[model samples]
Target: MKLDLTIPSLGPCHVDSPLKLSKQKGISTFNYSDDTQKILYDTSLKNFEACLAKGEAPLAFEKAGPREKIYFDPSKTKAAIVTCGGLCPGINNVIRGLVMGLYYRYGVNNTIGIKYGYEGFIPSFGHPFVELTPRNVADIHKSGGTILGSSRGKQNVSEVVDTLDRHNINILFAIGGDGTLRGVQAIVEEIERRGLKIAVAGIPKTIDNDINFIEKSFGFETAFTTANPIIRDAHNEAKGAYNGIAIVKLMGRDSGFIAVNAALSMPDVNFVIIPEMDFELEGENGLLAAIQRRLAKTKHALVVVAEGAGQFLFNNELGTDASGNIKYHDIGIFLKDKIVEHFKKQNMPATVKYIDPSYIIRSAPANASDSVFCGKLALNAVHGAMAGKTGFVVGRWNNQFIHLPIPVAVKERMKIDLQGELWWNVLEATGQPMEMKS
Candidate 1:
């Protein structure tokens, strides 16, 4: 894994040991640090050639905001905060953190909380605005749901723009998941269309950890840790009865981070199902067959399934929610029914138990790790917004707060890398087969 920078026809282009090279033709090349260059030099020739053909360096995340003046003057700045989408563990912590950051760090006391997401900003809805202060947000971090409340459904763009203008908000911080970020993107576009200089920043808030490129999303740790006891209960329940199978379904609409991580957290899980991988209910290595095999080895078995798993077996006429995300068929119930039916067909006595703890897991308060992460996300979002960095979501990348553009954040949903270490570790821990037939 080495690279020789000598050009074929031009002989050796003389340069310093450390040099900045830009592509001669295109403007798509990326700036590489000295360390990045060294890494590139140590890479394989095939990969190095591929990197050159792409006309960009190996991915690099730059800091957000411009090199010019800041966007807001503390004395004259007014900020707005809103929460959207489903409940997660750290929503309240984020609200309290943002309020404290604005009030104490920047001395901006004119922060307004928009209730019920974008709907609250519409004039028809009374344009509900709650003036926030340190005193009011003191104990909010100890709560679970957002103090500002939340809702789904997209609001009128023009009306939202009008409301922001009427409120004279200098910056806005949106706390939610991908759908919420898209909504924020619309608001920012409208503000730009109106020639307003208001800055918008998003705080990634998906408990599923499905937002692409974000190393970690707030509340995932809290949700995963909180779900451990539930999984243990399922495991214990399986052991209580003879020939018992317990299937516990966790949350993960599009991705299976929660299901996979919960399997990792609770090692007693005999089988784990996720949306990323496919498995069948019958046939040689299918799920039902696999459960029978496990039961042959042990009297009881515990299974963990993501809510979004085994969706291909369901009806084609699937539904969607307000965010336009496809509604997932219940994998837990489907697994339970199939297991029971298989046992009955074999003339074997068995008890199948299904537990869905989605609501209970998502509604819990933030744990220590998530509370700290939520605070960092909030502080960074506010700092980025105040610095005129708009149209970006503040997320932790490489263990640092980075301003990821909204478009990039929502471009693709992050799923478990089936071939990656995390999945491999899950396999090692659960002793599950890599593939279950087709």
Candidate 2:
């Protein structure tokens, strides 16, 4: 197969993207198409904006003078460990490694986990924030959620820096996905402006593999493991039911990686919808028609839909839509209602159940493989922050824990290659509806 790539250059909408193909011996000539160029430019521009918005440095930008990393001698001070974002598996494991590594291994005792993410930086609600030592995190490796709670809130730069100053926090370790990193960066920028001495590092920790800044974010493998069982349970449960349809929803707020992966793993899934999958509202019967067609002689249907999929197009609970109607407490219910309506129209015997597997999968125990990867990533982030490096996120690349410059994390949307060996075959064989468009 000859591979060609297109980039927008020369003229806006006029010049075509250029491509170079690889043949047996060498590379091919440069070719261009207007459509390719336009797409290339548009994608690049959006990513560029994301980088700026996140305060992530550009991958292509060249560093000037005095741009070097700073190394902290851990023999002196303790680091801060924080977890933000929705709960994911292996979070406790990361803290376990960090606490253990800083205490017993490195002789640093003052490790504190910021409570409720950034929201718990200070004492409020009678909590006054909490602190963590190696003692508290000792048994956490086997635990599922965070020993320290997490929250979704606006960035509090000054207050966080003030807390750091009061606590004498020197090295900061932030554990979460992209949003948490943004919070970390906000604090770092404040410290820099105020001339405070501190180091910051971020651990990629989202069940959704959409953290583009890093490859193979932590908690992903475990999320996949957690997700597979739910899908399998649902898929198999379909085989034994009477005129039944089970619509299952898994978590992935803005990304569809989880949904795509789950649906592909199960061969019996009749319909799969993810944010990345192109879908539009059909007259109530369209989805029903698809389900009815996929209904086996057993009259049972299994469908896996991403929690965040089709959020903008449909209502989850009632006839009217609200602001956060984009999110649903039970996505399965939404699908089940529509499915039941379809069956009712056809006058077929029908029953529906909506399984909200959000917490079920995300709060489960860490898988062995995921724990290994999470530990390795946590260690690498510590090394990076101590090294005075800025902007890069720590993740697994090519089966190894590595540091990706913040710029890389911001600009690229990591996509699964649908034509690749394992992924391609698995998805195709199942007859799932994931569109393989770049």
Candidate 3:
């Protein structure tokens, strides 16, 4: 699908940047980015050639960094930050980064934290906004979750915009996933309808790494890294007994990036199931039969499945969550029961162990890699908002940080390509069947 990469702006930039950096290229000099700088959306030569052949310009995103001039006045600007949706590893790091970047880098000291997602904006909720400064946020990065707190569900757009106006907020930094970004879009619409000049900037937050046009979201690396050792533990559990089996379920609602990467990180995984691929249960070529075959030869097996995998097996209707997300059936427990039943029918004694580490992995402190990445995302978001950019998200694309319009970023989630190298590598690592369908 074609994408529009244009970023909306509040107005022309007039105030010079507080960051003093040498414009010329030198050993110690730093360069500032301008609106003209762009990063290509597609890096593949085939797609680039195809676009040129069709006489269409390759889509590109505006590069994210400090500009020579900004729109918001440092001394008078008031900014607020809010986090919504599920917990991730790097939320605190992002919050601290924003506060430090605003106070130390841009000379903007007037900042406040919105408590409990968008609900904090509604007057009826009676939630108080926390005043943010460099001192309080200095040590928040050592922990997980947001200091500002978070919640699910959508708030009324009019009420949210009303809060921003009441607080005289000049800029807003929203941190969350697809649902949160959609909320940002609605708030932006409301702000424009009322002819408000508040700048809205989003920092895409999803442990699943499913945001579109973003190469990798913060906390994803830390999440998969945290899961690697858990897979090893499952492998050890399987090896401790005869015909032993271990089933591990990881986080992935519509995509299986964490499951795929965690399985690849450890080679002991014998079977990898994901939402993108379908598998049968009761045939000679099904997952149960495959597990039986593996146990027959190795006497032990490890299966890593994404939470959204094998959803077709369920016949009952599941309701949606507070955030309007479909409630998925627990695939880990389902597999455990089916495997034990199949073995009992065959008169074969087996030991089955099921592990779900979804919450634990997501709520841990950000690792070194994610901490640095969170800092970059937060700082870039501050830069964009200070320069009057609105209705855009700060993300990494093709190894360069760039600004992505909220509509474009939330258009569709990034899913695994079955024919792509990442999946191919997973298949090669696990030695699992190409298809588990009967």
Candidate 4:
């Protein structure tokens, strides 16, 4: 069980005098140089530069600065903000930033907070809209969770639209993950069908970071940072016993961004399993056998598995949530049970520590990085909506804010690129056996 000692070293990857980007006249300008811009975009750069020629180019993410654009008369606009899906860090930051952006920056004093996501619009739920002001939402960013709250259910598009029209909402900011964005899509379709003049803007809120086309969703860094301590605790617990195994399961039902990042953050992990990769349970190359091999070499071993990992071994009969997302099998508990059984069958003694810190990570407030990200996304969403841009979500494309069409955003789920640099980093960090040979 000797681990690979010759880890690949990352070479210097820096450039002098990087592209200078500036915001002017509601457009982000990248002072293009022949060398970098050509290689960066290839032929696609032509389309972007063409847009810039037409006075439309988004800010490059490398610049990472703020810009101001006034698309609507603040005095006559009414914007509504609603959050759905499960809680994640920085939800409140987005809410606060959106409120502040609309009320103060745009002079749009009439901002409404829809309680409990789209459910707030259903008449039977009795979840009415609350007026959002700078005074009321000033300190909301200091805490976690949404001040407007959230829920998950397939809402009636007609009812939701009626509610929006009844309230005379001009700009609607829907914040949630994939399912939430899908719901917004339906609402937008209804608006178009009915010939309404409402604008819909979405804030991508996938804690799992599974939504496609967005580089990195908000709260992902916060989740990874928060999970570091939890995994460290597991490592310590495993080390305390004679032959110990620590198996920690994290959120990421469809992708393994959280699990892989968490594993990279901790060096004690001996194995990292994600949903994108397949692993067995009983054979020599199986997860249990891997643990046995690691235990033979060391007194303690740490394993990290994404919730969606090893799902193929579980039963096919799955239950769907209110949003129709299938609930994943409890990989953490299942691994714990199998480990105990495997050791018992061999008459070997071992201690297994199981840790699930999902709720804690999701419930915490945004870290400093996420706070800034949420602020920028919220601000840009406001700008896009007021400019009559509908059916789009504000997302970070190559680091700059791009008003990603909701259809494009929800077209596919973003998964960890196994062959990409991030996964390579994870593999190097864990030093896990790439091919668990029998």
Judged by TM-score, which candidate is best?
A: 3
Candidate 4 RMSD to the correct structure:
9.9
Model 1 — which ten-residue stretch has the worst lDDT?
Answer: 5-14
Ranking by lDDT: 3, 1, 4, 2
Give all TM-scores, in the order shown. 0.87, 0.75, 0.98, 0.86
Evaluated at residue 23, the lDDT of candidate 4 is 32
lDDT of 1 by residue, 237-332 (tens): 999999988989999977999988888899999898999998788898888888888888898999998888889888675678988888777778
Stretches > 4 Å off in candidate 1: 1-57, 64-69
Higher-ranked by TM-score: 2 or 4: 4
Q: What shift in Å separates residue 32 of candidate 4 from its native position after superposition?
A: 18
lDDT of 4 at 357: 88
How many backbone overlaps does candidate 1 show? 0
Name the better of 1 and 3 by lDDT: 3
Clashing pairs in 1: none
Residue 406 of model 4, lDDT score: 72
- The whole-model lDDT of each prediction reads 0.80, 0.63, 0.94, 0.79
Candidate 3, 1-438: lDDT as tens digits: 477789999999999998987789777776899999989988899989999999988888999999989999999999999999999999999999999999999999999999999999999999999999999999999998889999999989999998899989999999999999999999999999999999999999999999998999999999999999999999999999999999999999999999999998898999999999988998989999999999999999999999998899999869999989999999899999999999999999999999999999999999999999999999999999999999999999889999999999999899999999999998899888898887
Candidate 4's displacement at residue 181, Å, is 0.3
Candidate 2 vs 4: which has more lDDT: 4
> How well does candidate 4 score on lDDT at residue 257?
90
Candidate 3: stretches off by over 4 Å: 25-28
Give the number of colliding residue pairs in candidate 4.
Answer: 3
